[model samples]
Target: MDGRLRVVIAEDAAIMREGLTQTLTRRGLDVVAAVADAQALRLAVEEHRPDVAIIDVRMPPSHTDEGMRAAREIHRDLPGVAVLVFSQYIETRSATELFAEQAGGVGYLLKDRVADVGEFVEAVSRVARGGTVLDPEVVRHLLGAARRADALSTLTPREREVLALIAQGHSNAAIAELLTITPGVVEKHVAAIFAKLGLAPSTGVNRRVVAALRYLGS
Candidate 1:
């Protein structure tokens, strides 16, 4: 067994499945299995137990959310394996549901992101290592569709901006630099954001992920 990251591709489209298998293989990752439907994807993951499974949100028969359902099942039954779900169109509800249930070793991205091979591979690697990744567009939708409008309305404009960056998986220092403010200021804003949203104050990546999930009203 090679030490490279093992991956399983579960895309219904033949072209996409082959393209991803070849792309990941060329990038030095092991493509243990590539399947076209949700059932095959589940079998591949159970058999190979790859480090990560890349799945399409829609697949087979109804083409509704077979892949997403399979992903949820895998995440529940095999906590060690990561799942990265991508969709051709943005589905805010699906993204919210996924992150709400599985905080670590999960990601939701748009299919268009595959066009940038480098970023796509990085996202896959990040998820495989138990890190969370959310597409910027998905973050926007989550922020906009937040259910707690009254609570969200209480945030200052700056606080709201900081929350948006947080939901995009940015660190405090990164948010500070992007907003051209000191880290201290970013910290204050983060605390305030959590307070206004009725979340417990904490630190680190997991805390930020929880804050992001809370921001999505999950």
Candidate 2:
């Protein structure tokens, strides 16, 4: 694998599609294929085997969750290829569905919040390298949902804070830095949160993502 990250874009709008391609290309990412529909996006993924796929929520045929469903299929089938769902709407259900089973290499970001191109590119890179990324707004929505209130109530305030950071795709080190705590303490809190959430210890899975899924009640 070369140093340059490879990408595929699935957007129904031509202008947005081409603009993303140009923007990522200018930032040194390899835009292997940019298509406008789910089928085309799948074909591009199969052909290019890019490092990451940037997908929009609404696309062709139904203009609803076509892109969301496609993103799930790609992640389930091709675990190596990361997926970053870039959408204009903050669909909490869609976000939960995308990250339900997967651990790393998955992300959901609202299109309107992408004000900085550099940060957006960094998100793409992060997902490509097998990391999770979620919009803070999405995190807040999930955290505030009443359905998960009973389960979440078991967590201490600090543990809840740690869980929020985890859902936001922050590493223990990053969370520690943000909260002004030590990484060792962050690890302890993470372990405790997983336990309280009843997420059994397992291998070949991202506990952080599972914890987030539990947080989202997905």
Per-model TM-score versus the true fold:
0.66, 0.66
Instruction: Kindly give the number of clashing pairs for every candidate.
Output: 0, 0
> What TM-score number comes out for model 2?
0.66
- Candidate 2 C-alpha lDDT tens digits along 1-218: 77799999999998999999999999999999999999999999999999999999889998988999899999999999999999887666666767887979999899888899999999999999999998998888765553455667889999999999999899999999999999999999999998777677788888889788777654
Position 209, candidate 2: lDDT: 92
Alpha carbon lDDT at 61, candidate 2: 96
lDDT of 1 by residue, 51-72 (tens): 9999998999789889988988
Clashing pairs in 1: none
Residue pairs in clash, model 2: none
Model 1, position 215: C-alpha lDDT score: 67
lDDT of each: 0.87, 0.89
User: What is residue 77's positional error in candidate 2, in angstroms?
Assistant: 0.7
- Superposed Cα deviation of residue 29, candidate 1 (Å): 0.7
Q: What C-alpha lDDT, on a 0 to 100 scale, does residue 202 get in candidate 2?
A: 82
